[model samples]
Target chain A: MDINILLVDDEADFVETMVKRFGIRKMPIDSAKSGQEALTSLAAKDYDVIILDVRMPGMDGLETLKLIRARAPLTEVIMLTGHASLEAGMQGMNMGAYDYVLKPADFDDLLDKVRKAFERKQLNAKARKQGA
Target chain B: MPRPANRAPEPASDPHGDPKGILARATGARLWKDHSLLLWAHFLVPPVLAALVVAATFATPILAGILAAIVLGIAAVSARGLLSRLSQTEEARLALNTQLIQSQKLAAIGELSAGIAHEINNPIAIIAQEAEWAAHLIGEAEKGCSADFAEVKDSLREVRAQVDRCKNITHKLLDFARKREPVLQDVDVVRIIEDMARLVDKEASYKNVTLVRSLPQDLPKLRTDAPLLRQVVLNLMTNALHAVDTGGRIEVSALADDEALEICIKDNGCGIAPENIDKIFNPFFTTKPPGQGTGLGLSMCHTLVDGMKGKISVASKPGQGAAFTVRLPRRV
Candidate 1:
């Protein structure tokens, strides 16, 4: 029931609104204002899921996913997009985002995708430990 | 607004460059420059030759007459040749001009369609949704009256169909003008037609243009891009729709013949001028206002038809409106 999550997005309103929504749903969460802040958070702490938005100005979603995969290879990042752009979604997937959701998104789908990502990350961790 | 009587500047200066200019010039030029010189040369040359051939013939009076006859024959042949050359040159120029105009129209249509699709997409969706809600309320209220429900359903379907038609027409207009390959497939004509109808249904409705269709029982299919054919049908129907006045009827029908299937869109709008009839298929010719029409619709249709080894023709009378015929080779 306890799921640690990092939400990184430049749109303060969207980030705050989603934070409130997740709080109501009782999901453990940390919020970051930018990609660098998200990286710093990951370095300092651990999270099960990272929800990122695609169209951030300087450090966009794809770049964030790249850095996240490099730094926290085990953690899963889900891309949240504003417009349903086919190109951005494919790029996000290619860059190793767990799953992509369109904005004004279905919260249930977001939850389902995050839950699967968490389960996958756990399996990956166990596999690494056994290999070690 | 009063129509400007002299919008074209006395119709001269560029008189040498209308689509009909070459033909007019060849036939209408004041005098043949070479004719006078040739006439004088003929009179002089024949006498010298005749004198050389026969001193007796030269002395006879018919030599001068013979030379004059020869000059007349030459002029007739030269005039014939000039007329033929003028027509050919005009046709060639027209073909080039058509391609240019068609390309421009396609570009403009694409830009407009994409913009309209994005801008009006929300409103169209909302209108459709609101229309749905009204339809629903009617259904609910009239459940007790079976006849009322039946009538309501029928009318709502009409409204729904109309909305979708506008959507299709606009989308088709846009895509036709965009001129991209747009990924072809073995598209079902029914769906494409419905899509186009929906796009333009709103426009048609506002214009008081009634759309009536007679699709074939089982029309032949084609291996073509959906977007492209949608463009072709869209252009024809939109043109026909615009031509017709409010309360006028537009008959859009699709049929099949040997190795070919066709769509003929007929409108009860003001028809083409007899002089402009043939020129309509040429480039940059439109009955619509300058900004309203790029005059590429028919040309694009021709280019598309030609590409498919198909053909398009128009039948019209001055006051009776026009019918556009589109025939495409049936794909096996």
Candidate 2:
């Protein structure tokens, strides 16, 4: 599946490392430092999956998810929580999120989830098209 | 607040180093203690006098009786006022002491965890980066070289995995040390478990571990912090995975009655030692080797469960594996 991804987090070093690693894998990736920046990027481009940090400074991951669902219903959202609280993940899922992943996650594991989420989104789009 | 002009001059050096200031402060403290004791005795005297006057009224004349009545009335009012004020001050002092102790514990935990994270994570990050760089360079060189690089590649992979493991422990250490305000909500326990299982199922399979989940279909929804509860369960489940060898069985079962909902994670792995069982939940106390665990997982789990007004306990015997049970109040 062709997936365009956006990573939103306040941790610059983590983001840089992830972006470079994913770049080596030839995955299409973009990043933002804050929720506001994430929203701006979301408006500027169409991404299949948005990996959002739950503990950002302003407009946290949940709030950003709300705007994403409102603006682009077809776009899937994956929450990333640094701490091991599944509550944040569940909250995100309840708020119409695609899924959630823990931080410091294995890259292969994360990539597998991202691919599955993108495929799910693509299937939904195809269904909508067929219905129309 | 400025010191009085007649008061002794402030010490220019440490109290221990300045003999005169130390002596003066000690004397002043002792005098203040004596004064407070006298004041407390003064408050107690009125109540005693009131009781004595009431007892003596039976042996006195009519005029003396009237005088005793007035004295008793004034004493009663003063005694009541003093006792209430004294109790209030005592309560305030107790509360301040409790708060002081709590803050001290939190401060110490914060400092220790921060120190561990800083001291360990920086080195871990560098090691991981250097390993990745070396692997990259080796990959490039392998394109032209005819010699076997299989062992070199396998060693580099092992190094990277160890670095990642160190990173995970440091991250968990910071998680345990940092205080969090859990946002509570009405939660479906079943859903939370499913989510946690989804996250761990891959690893369970990779380890050849069998995960058996048993929950009643009629289980009621729980009213508590979902994330905290999920964390506690996940930690227990992960610990169970580690305790058992490949092909071992781990059962996660949930049951609820009238009082509380209980979730148990039981594994048929190498059971905890008799001496180590009691210390399992203590921070930095691990049975695992040095590089394998930071020993923060169970402690953090304990903290999270306690924060939710829940209880966590364990039962185990050598050669019988272990069982961790978490009890959460069933509000809804």
Candidate 3:
């Protein structure tokens, strides 16, 4: 699968590490350190999946997801957070996020979610193309 | 992270028009029900007796005088004792209520700290994983007989060790917030100090500060919580870093005597002020600007050390830097 993923978080070290790890796996991945940067990256290129952190300085994950869906409805978003708040998770889902994952998440689980989200995105794109 | 943007305005939903009016109305009702007769008699009795005395003085002077004295004596003594005792009891209840409020506040703070710890753990995990990956790469490079292999290996080891320290900090913060009991074990202060020195070496150099270690070879292992002890040392080291500027020096030394082990962190930077010395270990007391410090570092250190039956002290003056010494009992 040709998966283009965008990882958004405030932690630079985490972004660098994940970028390197994804690179080693031969995946095309990009990183943004804040929500504004993430939105800019989203506008510039088409991504199959976005892994976004919920808590950020400005333009939180939920807000960014809202704008992304409006701008590029085909893109799938998987929310990530260190602290687990059920209300936040539910609100993110309500706001059209594909799924929510907690921090220090098992690599296998996160990869599973990302792959599923990408597959869903591809399906939606194909459906839209057929409709056109 | 961010302060509350806007507070929602409260609504006026009181059934009663005003709180004070409601209180007064309730008090008035109770007063009328409980003591209306006594209150009315209190005012009427003296005047009625005086009128009786004046009228009876013309008839029987002895009877009127005795009646007046008895009524005055009973009114004076009865209410005085009851009022004083009631006020004393109220005062005691108020003090107990204040104490209850304080404990509740502490409990709330504990829960907040736990939430913060969870947030911090994610970044620590990332840093740790990155360090691990770097270590793997370094191990591979070492196989190629690289000239800089030794230095790279040492630096990677330091990074990994410090990441572990960061992990411990998050764990300890959660445990402390949950009020969990510490797990005691034999901890070597020498090794702890060495790891901490390595951890802060990069930061120290970045600020052009000299880092020194002075652990003697003959120190004994101390019994305590390893992570908590590491946290204390880490907090002290980080504080020392902020206390100094360029060309400043920090020395970490450990010594063991017959009964206890002493680890001292000395710095040649800006020392704490005399007034702040006493409040240095207080929660939320910080000299650094908002967002720079949580102000919990030293207070948490103080709590952990005290939990281990240890003592931590500081000695310093303005412009002369400070030294923090932690004394823990030595274990065989």
Can you list each candidate's DockQ? 0.02, 0.05, 0.01
Q: Answer with 1 or 3, whichever has the higher lDDT.
A: 3
Steric collisions counted per model: 21, 1, 0
TM-score of chain B for predicted candidate 3: 0.49
Worst 10 residues of 2 chain B by lDDT: B1-10
lDDT per residue for candidate 1 within A44-68, as digits (tens), equals: 9888889997888878878888889
| Model 1 per-residue lDDT tens digits across residues B176-294 | 33322223345567655654565456567777778887776577666654434666777777777778899888887887778677778888889999999867865457878755665
Compute fnat per model. Answer: 0.00, 0.00, 0.00
lDDT tens readout by residue for model 3, B80-175: 844764565456456544534543444455456566777888888888888888888878877888466778778878988877766655654554
DockQ pick, better of 1 and 3: 1
**Can you rank all candidates by lDDT, best first?**
2, 3, 1
The TM-score measured for candidate 3 stands at 0.38
TM-score for each predicted model, relative to the true structure = 0.36, 0.46, 0.38
> How would the candidate models be sorted by DockQ, starting from the highest?
2, 1, 3
DockQ of 2: 0.05
